[model samples]
Target: MKSFSDKLLWGIIVLLAAAMAITAAVKLSPLLNPPQDISLPLNAACDLHQGPCTTSLPGGGRLEFSLEPRPIPVLRPLRLQVRATGIKADSVEVDFAGVDMKMAFNRPRLVSGKEGLFTGEATLPVCVRNKMAWQATVLVEADGQRIAVPFRFETKR
Candidate 1:
């Protein structure tokens, strides 16, 4: 037979143990399943230049590009508008694998209630023509993670 005092003490002990268990479980939950890496699909629209063409991305969180009019119009340059969200990267590099154009930019650190927007311009190789459809892939890296997004366009003479 247990005394009343013993029962009271046991009840308190049980509650304390339960609390400790809950705390431990929550602390270890994140470790058990860490965040997985993910890549988003590329978002872009194609436009042809009558005199001067421009592609605009809203929310300042998108990339916009344009090409200059050419006499031969064989190859044209690509202008890029890049935006960063929830990141604090010191630098960023844009590489056009399909074409010979490559560029790098210094991105401003991410701030509270505001995302960093980067805009740059580059010229495509002169050999690129409308007959050959090309793919331009953009790689954005921040916080030790890299994301690749692709855009495609054809030049029409």
Candidate 2:
């Protein structure tokens, strides 16, 4: 038969083991199950209006994103272009999202051109504020999987 002190010692060890496991699980939760919406980060200083910004894809490949009409006009037909390399893509799309506020759904499927170039057009809704921040998420679909690269830009009225 186990003595009382031995039983208490075993119980304490088991409780500590459980506590350590829980702590590890809590600390590593985000790394284990990353958020699904996470996309490739774009440089904060990058100016899509001035020129195209290029970023590497998750697995492999390079994506060049750009918005047209330097200064990025609002309520006017805006041109969007993306040049991607090193991946077989089924389709490409650009989803516009307002950073400061929620706006109507605006997603445009870009037409593929020669040599992995995709182009599309869209009109941005007028914002109440003079300057509005926006995020353009480029969605690339291939082999039943989708990859997104997000670019942030601001529009001035």
Candidate 3:
């Protein structure tokens, strides 16, 4: 009787462990195979508040990013635009993150336009501080490669 009970306990333990492993794998698969970010090597700096800024692509193209309504404001729907001159951009997404603080995941995919142009709308969350720093990363997928273009700017509340 004792031996039988021990075997049953072991079986239950094994099942629970297997279940946990499967759950972890499912949750972490995206992190393991996330889109390639090519922003580290090429730290392209741009002031989005100003009209438009252009950055050179890795292969051999130029990417221009612009924000509508000049002087970005928080809690407003701002029009974001991207135009890729040289690269064949299939998909484009903008990821916003607070540079000085940890905020929620805010990434919006842009609608592909004619040729290499992509447009989207995004709103920045309000912060407790008077001024906040943000980093907006433009993700471009072209020729089976995901390139990340990061830009930094500050906004006041």
Q: What is the lDDT of residue 31 in candidate 3?
A: 49
Return the clash pairs for model 2, or none. Answer: none
**Model 3 C-alpha lDDT versus the unseen true structure:** 0.84
Give lDDT tens digits, candidate 2, residues 84-156: 8987777888888899799887888999998899999999999999999999888887666777777899898
Quantify all predictions' global Cα lDDT against the true fold.
Answer: 0.47, 0.84, 0.84
Total clashing pairs in model 3: 0
The per-residue C-alpha lDDT of model 2 at residue 42 equals 64
Clashes of each: 3, 0, 0
Best model per TM-score? 3
lDDT tens digits by residue: candidate 3, 1-157: 5798899999999999999999999997664445675763434456778678888887789898887767899999989999999888899888888898988778889999997889999998999999999888888888888888888888898
Return the TM-score for candidate 3, rounded to 2 decimals. Answer: 0.79
Ranking of all predicted structures according to lDDT, beginning with the best and ending with the worst: 2, 3, 1
